[model samples]
Target: MKVMNCPLNGPRNISEFAWGGEVKPMPDPAGVGDKEWAAWLFLEANEAGVVREWWCHVPTSYWFIAERNNITDEIIKTYPATEVFNTRVEFAAKAGAGEKK
Candidate 1:
């Protein structure tokens, strides 16, 4: 059976986890253009060899990072997302969404 080590929950079955996506720089939600935002959300580098990706432990709802070899499908390492993302991203509230016209 395949297994993956979750940063918070220790070793677990691979089926208990979910592959979120390839880790990439997120564009500014307010400042970025629509096309650019769409590209960032939909497109991926899809490169071969080792790549960093976001993964989630389904049972615990814990998110983390994983370095894996896409070509051979081997997980090189796994760690908490906090190791890389040190800051929390706060989004500004939309203008006049709740106010009466």
Candidate 2:
């Protein structure tokens, strides 16, 4: 059986995890146009070498990062997202947005 080491839950069955996507710098949602936003949301680099990606532990709903080689399909390492992302970005609500009439 395949195994994956989750940062929060330790080693577990690969079935217990879900592949989120490649870890990339998020563009400013409010500043980008429809095309740019769409690309960011749907597109991927699909690189061949070792790439960092986001993964989730389904049972615990815990998300973390994994570095794996696409060609070899080998997981090089895994770690908590906090190791790469230390600061949180807050998006301010627009004026008169989502208010009842």
Candidate 3:
């Protein structure tokens, strides 16, 4: 069983959660052609490596963001489930490693 460390609530049970969609710019619901709209609806980005995502707390009815390495199921970070995801990006930029973003 893998453990995920959350920002607000640390070390949550993975089973008590649900996987949401990709944390990215979704397609514009308006101002698009038929083909573009269909593509957006069907196609999605499954980015490798450090992929940011949303998750729902099934047991608690809470939502949050998770920074996880998809291939390994290694959760790197977590944040409160919010519409504006700028907080997650800001935190990542500050927590620097060998290189900077």
Candidate 4:
């Protein structure tokens, strides 16, 4: 059984958590067309690499972000949702610089 570190609950069984899907930057909902909104809502990149995702602790109903490598199934870190904006910004900056974190 895999164990995941929950930001609020420390380490716990992976079964106690729910996969909340990938974390992507939100586009301005007001400016996007229906097609764009639909794509955003339904489509997933499913990239084969390190990706940041949202995970919810089912028992406590706490949601947090986890940076994991899809290929290896290794979780690098878990953090609160409040830190997501900064994490996304940092990830974007690294990508823009042609660097991987």
TM-score of 3: 0.65
Give the per-residue lDDT digits (tens) of candidate 2, residues 1-101.
Answer: 88989989999999999999999998886787889888988899998999999999999999999999999989899999999999898887978999999
The best-first sequence of candidates by lDDT reads 1, 2, 4, 3
Candidate 3 lowest-lDDT run of ten: 86-95
Per-candidate Cα lDDT values, in order, are: 0.93, 0.93, 0.71, 0.87
Off by over 4 Å in 1: none
lDDT of 1 by residue, 1-101 (tens): 98888989998999999998899999988899889999998888999999999999998899999999999899999999999999999988888988998
TM-score of every candidate relative to the true structure: 0.91, 0.91, 0.65, 0.81
By TM-score, how accurate is candidate 1? 0.91
Lowest lDDT 10-residue stretch of candidate 2: 29-38
1 or 3, which is superior by TM-score? Answer: 1
Clashes of 2: 0
Stretches of candidate 2 exceeding 4 Å from the true structure: none
Put down candidate 3 lDDT per residue, 1-101, tens digits, no spaces. 76666555668777777887776665444456789877766665887888878888776777788888988878888877564554432223323566746
Question: Total backbone clashes of model 1?
Answer: 0
